[model samples]
Target: MRALVLAILAALAVTGHSATVKAVHAEEREGFKVIVHPDNPARELERGFLRSAFLKKSTEWHGETVRPIDLATRFTVRDRFTTDVIGKTRAQLRSYWNQQIFSGKGVPPPEGESAAAVIAYVLAHRGAVGYLPASVDPGKARVVPVR
Candidate 1:
């Protein structure tokens, strides 16, 4: 029985089915910068409020419409933001948006093709909020700490 169990474990490892494998990629856990238009007025945000803003629950900030922007789903920074900030996986967010659309509630944030695009949009719009890799320079946008 001991030999059989050992062999089964070996097989599972060789097949890449180990249950102990970590799901998060190293790059995907790296920090992200949450940026808003410099004129947005808000300086900081709680994690819950940031998540709600991203999820489209809190639609306004200081009387101005809150426009949230997302990086493309395949971006590593976006994965980190979704996991650490929004508290959802990409697939889960997609499903949630689908449900919202079918219910006539709302749609997910518009996706930026790249970090530069996001930065540009935020800088150009008064209510824009978005995320980028921590390494990126935010240009004219204000970086908001997510606590």
Candidate 2:
């Protein structure tokens, strides 16, 4: 029985059916600088700024009178990866933040439906900042870089 088990295990390993996993690299995209409407009078973020700016400052919303938002849409890269980094699902992100808002802990950022919508909101409001896929062309709105 022991011999048979070892033989099966070896066969599975050779056939790529073993539990051994392979690592895949994430596709890296060029980063951008995040900017706001010129008329808004808020400062712009340099390249690679949003990650720290958005996640670090709890008082950020109070400063701008608007909360920070992220790309948590179902198909967005940030949406999928954030949960793995923070141990929470997207639904949990909304639910947990909603609970906080109810308890006056902190306000949650607005949820966007798509990248374009997120970008539009950020451009229109001085308080918003978000990332876009590298493929997107940077128009008048400020672009922010990502890893």
Candidate 3:
């Protein structure tokens, strides 16, 4: 049984499944949730998909342009989201965005001033998604399960 478990872990590490697992575990530890517009049909998301979306690599969802939102300034949940979901430290993410911008490749996502603003952005934009601490009220935004 131990050998089998180890084999499975090895396979996951080689295939990058372990990173997704880590993302899930990280969010659980961070106590944050991912939210989407109420109109979006996605009830769950893979952590990698979210990382791609936030990095602006995946720009559409369900025929709508994906609108990945973020907090305007540093916040605990923002830090957690970047680390757990985006897989980058805040400074790393900023440097990434800086490189993208310098090359005229992309820009960071729209940001909200507060949790309420984030919820409002999601509620107002059909393809929008954001993350907030679990303690925050999500208003009409639909909380999506993340793996």
Candidate 4:
């Protein structure tokens, strides 16, 4: 029985079934809804700015320090946000940040452990920006459209 199970697992691995499973899991996730501190006046953001801000290339927003928060790389919502807005995959991001650290360019934004933590961080910080699963409610926070 053990040998049969191992053989089946090896077959699945050899056939790329794991990638399909991850693809479907990511699709099932609702993706991210961008949220900002309620006091943030900018109602919308340019997508390019998000890429820069998240990368720490643009560090200020409206005279306040840009605090870009993120979900851990394991989350599917994070994958969606990175692909849709940041224009990089998680592995690509890791490589980019690695080079940045090596050259002292900058560091990637901090990551929240959970969706609620992300929302709370946004609410507590003055210039905080983050995302949550689309169905998650960001209490008293503003949803900024990404243009």
Candidate 5:
């Protein structure tokens, strides 16, 4: 049994399956774009502030109510955003939201069914901020720097 397990691990390493999986996920994350309504005056956001906004800890931006948007949990871009930007995995975020709900402190951001929907919401709402795949043209929305 030990030899069988070692052989399987060797095969996986030789085939680079583990590394390939990580590479694919990282490639998918490369095209994510963070955006806000063009009317929003802020050009760039600090990463800490962006995380706070999405986490629903900071409710306002420049004195206006902030409307943070999210993609559905199943989306790859959402996974990347959660992991790379929010510094939390999907499961961690779910747990966080559950705690918030039970405590009556906050709720998760509204989820967009698709990237197009997210962009549309950001463009139409004055205080909206969301992310989309880089392939989408932002139109009047302004891309916010995550860093």
Candidate 6:
């Protein structure tokens, strides 16, 4: 039985499946739920969803709207944060969004540029949400795990 378990573990490692399954935990940010617009069909997201969508899969966000936050700023806000969490740096995200916008493939979310702008935009638009330093105002929106 021990040998069988070891073989299974070895196979999982060799297949690289274990690496893809890394778990993401829920974390608190400023205050809001970090949510999609209530009208959006997306009900819930996993914590790693952003990383998977933007970084790994490069999935175009096609809901009511979406926004990208800076990796460095997010990292400064919390130790648990990662570029992989939001999927890319500010420049990389901007490049991709611009491509989508120009191609008419999709409408990119407005750029917050800074954490404060993110707070303001999210507060004003129920359909928009993005991450900000925990130090910023939380009342602007909700904080939901990206996944």
Best by TM-score: 4
Local accuracy by lDDT, each model: 0.86, 0.53, 0.87, 0.87, 0.85, 0.51
Candidate with better lDDT, 2 vs 4: 4
How many clashes in each candidate?
Answer: 0, 8, 0, 0, 0, 12
Better of 2 and 4 by TM-score: 4
Give the per-residue lDDT of model 2 (tens digit) for 26-111: 31123323434334454544322443345433345425744455655554455433443334555776687677779876665565
Candidate 5, residues 21-80: lDDT per residue as tens digits?
896577555568899988899978888888988998887887678899998866777877
Number of the candidate with higher lDDT, 2 or 6: 2
Candidate 3 accuracy as TM-score: 0.78
List clashing residue pairs in candidate 2.
Answer: 31-145, 32-143, 32-144, 32-145, 33-143, 33-144, 34-143, 35-142
Give the higher-lDDT candidate: 3 or 6. Answer: 3
TM-score of each: 0.81, 0.49, 0.78, 0.82, 0.79, 0.41
Better of 2 and 6 by TM-score: 2
Residue pairs whose backbone atoms clash in candidate 3:
none
Q: Show pairs that collide, candidate 5.
A: none
RMSD of 4: 5.6
For every candidate in turn, the CA RMSD to the true structure comes to 4.7, 7.7, 10.4, 5.6, 4.6, 10.8
- lDDT of each residue in 1-147, candidate 1, tens digit only: 999999999988886853324545665667898999887778788889889988999978888788889999768778789889889887898899999999999989999999999999898788889999998999888998978
Those runs of model 5 whose alpha carbons end farther than 4 Å from true positions after fitting are 1-29
Q: Rank by TM-score, descending? A: 4, 1, 5, 3, 2, 6
Worst 10 residues of 2 by lDDT: 20-29
- Report the alpha-carbon TM-score of model 6 versus the true structure: 0.41
- Candidate 1: TM-score? 0.81
Candidate 3 lDDT by residue in tens digits, 49-141:
999999999979998899999987556567778888889877899999999999999999988889899998888889898988888888889
In terms of TM-score, which candidate is stronger, 1 or 5?
1
